[model samples]
Target: MKRSNIRIIGVPEQQEEEQGLENLFEEIISENFPEVGKKKVTQAQRVPKKMNPQRPTPRHIILTMANVQDKERILKAARERWKVTYKGSPIRLSNDFSTETHLTRKQWMEIYKVMQSKGLNPRILYPARLSLKIEGEIRRFTDKKRLREFISTKPAMQERLKGLV
Candidate 1:
């Protein structure tokens, strides 16, 4: 499924000011995404991420963006900048997807990048499948194992994947 907004997750929980979640959200957006600024945000907040304390998953911040361009810019910056921080604490930005979609995207991360670098347009099908145009042919993979097997057989894919991985 397509997401209208991106999330700022893995931000260490912050003490709420008088404005609470809204203030925190604005602070992050203003600092990390100066181009978009606080005015463009439709909504923002911290949400619970259900994970074990043993693992210590940080609380997630959700941002309801004004448009896709703004969202994409923020996500791209987050990806390239790596571990953006606020008040000395590291934060992560991601698409605000359902848990299933998030897991699927994570699983296919490598292949997706490889496909893009190979000059193929790789599109993720909802619920976690990848479809791409490679060598003028459309190829789709619903499973990671099958995708890996396919990559192993193709020398070019194997070489590119090797350099990337």
Candidate 2:
């Protein structure tokens, strides 16, 4: 269900209604990926988080693509291109993960980077599972405790990842 949706950040706020947002979405696609013209958007709206008076950036827009393939195509393009902008200002496109899943992934980022730097080949699987390549084999961990246990088994990893797990 979340696969078809994307969250767009850094777009300036405007008083325009939903139709305006749809047009902006189109503009975003055209600006970043001209070949991927006019993909169907089932829904487009700003996220419902309460506005903070001190924050300068606008709330992110959550876009739902009618077809998951289109979403995938755009995401692939964004990854390859490395810069997706709208109206000359930088914007970002990413999967619309639930709060819990997003937080879980966020928690793994420090370890992910350390593993990556050490050439562990870490990957964050969908909905928040961490996978690592260890000695030509793949190992997947569903939670930090499991990962901690696995790391504890390896003396080298235990020393390197001390206090992180």
Candidate 3:
């Protein structure tokens, strides 16, 4: 599958009429990521999702970047910073993956959270590697079988999984 150029989420929707999305993108990049050039942005749009009318929140901002290096830089910066806030709310920025990959990563979300709650900072790497930081060292599991093997080594993880696994 082809890698997506760019996607940014959790950026607050500014309710200014004169300041369009393009302008907002420029503003965000300038404010949070000065190293990234706004001119590299090829396409930017809001990803639609179901909203609550009584308490509507910001829709995700997705973009296509012309420069792959710039995109990687932004993503890396965002990850290092953890949460980028706008209007007192947190925002997320990430790479846009193909549907299959996205769904595949999503399926193991419960395990991800379980590992996190156990003081393991686990992350799913591109093309699907389950990486976790444990005891000041980073360990990665290449596939589900390897991940399962690693988890089986941890009785705590097994106890927590119960039926979830």
CA lDDT of each prediction against the hidden true structure: 0.74, 0.87, 0.72
Residue 9 in candidate 3, Cα distance off native in Å: 2.9
lDDT of 1 by residue, 1-165 (tens): 556577776655645545576677678767776775554678776675577779877667677877777778778877777767776777777788778877877888887887787777788876678997778898889987787788888998787677443
Model 1 residue 140 CA deviation in Å: 6.6
In terms of lDDT, the poorest run of 10 residues in model 2 is 12-21
- Candidate 2 per-residue C-alpha lDDT over 2-60 given as tens digits, one digit per residue, 9 for 90 to 100: 57898999988772353488888998898889987789999988887786889868889
Q: Which candidate should be chosen as best, given lDDT against the real structure?
A: 2
Candidate 2 matches the true fold with a TM-score of 0.70
Off by over 4 Å in 2: 15-19, 51-55, 106-127, 131-140, 155-165
- Worst 10 contiguous positions by lDDT, candidate 3: 9-18
Identify the candidate with maximal TM-score. 2
By the TM-score metric, which is better: model 1 or model 3? 3
Q: Model 1 off-target regions past 4 Å?
A: 49-51, 103-140, 144-165
